[model samples]
Target: MANENGEGEDIPVAANVLGTIGTILWCIQLVPQIWYNWRRKKTEGLPASMMLLWATCAVPLGIYLVLQNVNIPLQIQPQIFGALSYVTWGQILYYDHGYSRLKAIVVVLAASAISGGLEALFILTLRIPYRKGTTWPALFFGIIAAIMLTLGLIPPYFEIRKRHGRVIGINWFFLAIDTFGALFSLFSLAAQKSFDILGGVNYILVALLEFGIYGCHTVWRIRNRKLLREAKKSGRSVDELLEERELERQRQRELESSNGERFTGIDYDEEKSRPSTEAHSVDGGFVQEPAGWHRT
Candidate 1:
């Protein structure tokens, strides 16, 4: 990413242009998901860990890009990404984790301060080595950023792979924009005077992971379309059917976890915590249970 001149070197026009566009897209890529979370008042499908991981990665990434003296857009992308990631993470804590507004705001502010301080320290420390013509520190930060970025996209796969599950919290618009941003970043690297292998690999890995997410999105769409048709014929709204489906899955899980006991809208331990050595039937009958069933 550094030129022989190390500063004020002319970058290719195409690289500059593509980097600009990619930067713009990346800046807004998370906006849709943030807005969706605000409107939905929850963050079910979107894991807070993913956003936190991204924010964590951005610190080192920003340090690396700035130290490497990459093009202006690439230099600033991590900073903006980190800020928005904190916002999204704040929303998740507030809505999904039941944190109070004040608590969530405090947490986000603390995180931002810590990351900003860390990035500053890293950049300052790495600049000394960079000025000494030692590039390993920059490379180290780049490698760390790449690994974090790759790991950040894994949590959502666990959600989407569940039975009859759909991509619930993440917005497709956000994903589409992100994919375009990745492609543009890759193209910018291709157009650059020096190909940054770390940067190129980072972008390529994200784009490929995003392709799998898009495929997951496609499967959800197909299943949802079928359910929509069924909803019409069954005189039930899609929401109702989806809710019923989720309840059914929850019941099945509870049933399996309780060793053939039925779910009755209460916690398993609470339901079985009675001192009597009998399980109460729905019809108010007392059925004998196995010994020590109440303890577990």
Candidate 2:
């Protein structure tokens, strides 16, 4: 348990430094995502689910770091910086993509809560159990983190290799950030000779997901782009094609309007032509009693 400084199991200055490096890597991860959103002015390809889960993990970790008497520097290194990254992502989604305020807020809040819960649970169990000479919390957290990390990438996997070249909910920029962030974390881990359960595995697995799946999507996107260019070069009428798309949309709207109107069951002509049946019936099938006398 002795750290290099002979500090008995105390977090080392070196670990703090590497934690700073990890924070920097996290900030860097936001860049690609932000840039993509800015360029596209949209969060179209971004996966809300992944961001939601990851942000959830970060917020709790942030809270845990704060509670641990870990210096602000260390806490800020990941917790503050990491939370900011999620916020930045959300902002891009809102301002760039014009997502409604409610939707953006939901994503932000969910991410914060999940991150805070996980971080708190991990640290509290670590500290409290260690004081009582128990490591079960650590084991449980490890298993949970592993499961989450593995499942987190499945959506992206389907997005990439589904035989139709669909990226599904995965964003290419987000994937790139995740991959490089993992690479950076691996490097940071190697440098500081420290391995934390969540950080290291998340880094590696995310990298693999990006390279294996998202990378394929990028290739397909490029291929499609090339085909589009060739079509343009051959004067295959790309604008006209897009125009036809707009026209089709209009037609669909028209059809929907017509269908809706037909189903509404309001007929002015019938209303105008219909007699007052109640009044006609009350007029008495020709005053039957008097009519009987007249007939007789």
| Decoy 2 TM-score against native | 0.55
**lDDT score, candidate 2:** 0.56
lDDT, candidate 1, 37-127, per-residue tens: 9999988889899999988988888888898786676677788889999999999999999999999999999999999999999888779
Structure candidate 1, residue pairs in collision = none
Candidate 2: where are CA atoms >4 Å away? 1-19, 38-41, 59-74, 81-99, 110-126, 161-163, 166-174, 191-200, 221-228, 231-296
lDDT of 2 at 13: 59
Return the TM-score for each candidate structure. 0.77, 0.55
Q: Pick the candidate with the highest lDDT.
A: 1
lDDT of 2 at 291: 21
